[model samples]
Target: MINKHVERANRVITVLFYLGSTLLFILLILSGSINHFPINKFYWLSANTSNIPGAPYDISRWTFWGLCAEKNDKNVCSNYLSPAYPISPKDNFDTTTNLPPSFVSNRSTYFYLTRFDFVFFWLGLIFTGVNTILYIFTFCSYSFTKVVWFLQILASVFTISAVCMQTAAVAMAKNAFKNYGDDVSIGPALMGISWAILFLTICLFFMTGGTFIKKGYKHHQNYVEMSKYKEDALKYQQYMNSTKPINTDNASNPTDPYSLPSTYDEGYQQQNAEKQQQQQPVDIIQKSAGVIQQNPKSSVKFFHFKKTKKIPHNDDGSV
Candidate 1:
């Protein structure tokens, strides 16, 4: 049987995970849109371009929307652009004199990858938002759970794609800088948040899908009742077999639906014997007895016949 408390707890946990994922996604999307405490701090790639004369800033950081140049303790960021282009010395600063060979050779490769990463991130965020809005409806019916599961699947696909693209683009950029003998490092904050969101998304997907396997409350109750009835019937049969001799000859199969109660007593069994016999005629009794004997492990109760009453007939037709 499905415990109501356990079900409620699972729902609460799933909701919490969903909320966490949504919040992280929002944070990721807003990282490069503005220059502020947390946002200005979050970037995918950071490099020391102090020695590169053509480089505009001593230190450059790549964000989701644009690039930021950090000097001293302050950051001077460019205007936010949708689908921001990645940091390529030749493309961004308009000079490639002291840039890495890989940066020039693979400039277009980084550009398209970062752009698609931005796009897929937004797509994933949108799907997650839809799921958040429709999540409450899932509690109203099982059909809504299925709907939410589908939405979770779509969200997972986009989120995974975004994370993969972001990781690939940033890793490639960092490697190029390293190979050029320049000081470079990948941004831990951005990568951490992105991967965290993906983790939450995956967890939510499986939790929502698990609801499909759950049986309804009514179904659980029915199953429990049938199980209890069978248990009681089995116990009674064992008790009777141990206490009394088996009348194999007189024993006839019975087809009656009635079964022995859990707490069997001699008085109660004797009193109900006649009524049980009345309910199941002799033919039914013979059949049921045969069935029970064949399968002694069966839950069907065996009934003992006591006596049958006879009706008197009038001698004359007029009477």
Candidate 2:
């Protein structure tokens, strides 16, 4: 029965792989770019804005059609691929830098986690709330393999932990600035940490959703096996009940169809063979009559019946 559950889990895994890939594409875009493409190009307008909060930017204004840098220029859309920008006047960069940064990041984590009280409150409490919710959802359904499900659940934990760490690091950086008074650039450090947090959070979304789907398939397989087992067991029990005391001394006894015997009858005629033996009385009588021999003077005689034919054309009244 678990095999059926396993098979369904297999099919679901295929679908999940595709779905996960699709979702990973979206997630990559949401967190930042994967290569030059935004995975969620379906909603490119919204996802493109995730990192550059309050940058006075709109994804629509940055469309391929509007960005006139044209066939030879990829930089127009390239700027949207990341939160950071290079010194390209022909593109949508807000500020000029030497080159794009190594990894993509959401700019918002920099702002939220840099404050001390915020880190202690959310990292210690709010993220814990989200983690609890995911755990509940995971166990409420287990049709998925324990392994893949574990990966997803594990991903969620790491994401939350990363978020907490990011918050703590940012607050420490800011506190360092408060003590030393403008000695370090807290902004850049906070920005880098926030990117890491974004990656983990995006991973959390994919892993949990995929694992949940796997669980559904496992359940489907289990359900199928259970139904088949029940049907076969019922049939077998009915067969056993059928032969329970066949007083077939009479064949017409009333019984429920459910209790009827289901065995095939190859030797049924053999059972009623006594009736065939009982029918030999006529043959015995004939044989006995033939076997007796008597003298010609015996009272019993053999008689031949005579055949009569009518005379044709007796016209003269002669006999």
Q: lDDT tens digits, residues 241-295, model 1?
A: 7665533323333432235543657786676666557756776878988998899
Clash count list over all predictions: 10, 3
- Assess the local accuracy of residue 263 in candidate 1 as a C-alpha lDDT between 0 and 100: 64
**For candidate 1, what is the lDDT?**
0.77
- Local distance difference test values of all predictions, in order: 0.77, 0.40
Query: For model 1, where is the 10-residue window of minimal lDDT?
Result: 248-257
For lDDT, the strongest prediction is 1
Give model 1's clash tally. Answer: 10
| Candidate 1: regions farther than 4 A off | 51-54, 72-74, 80-82, 213-319
Of candidate 2, the 10-residue stretch with the lowest lDDT total is 64-73
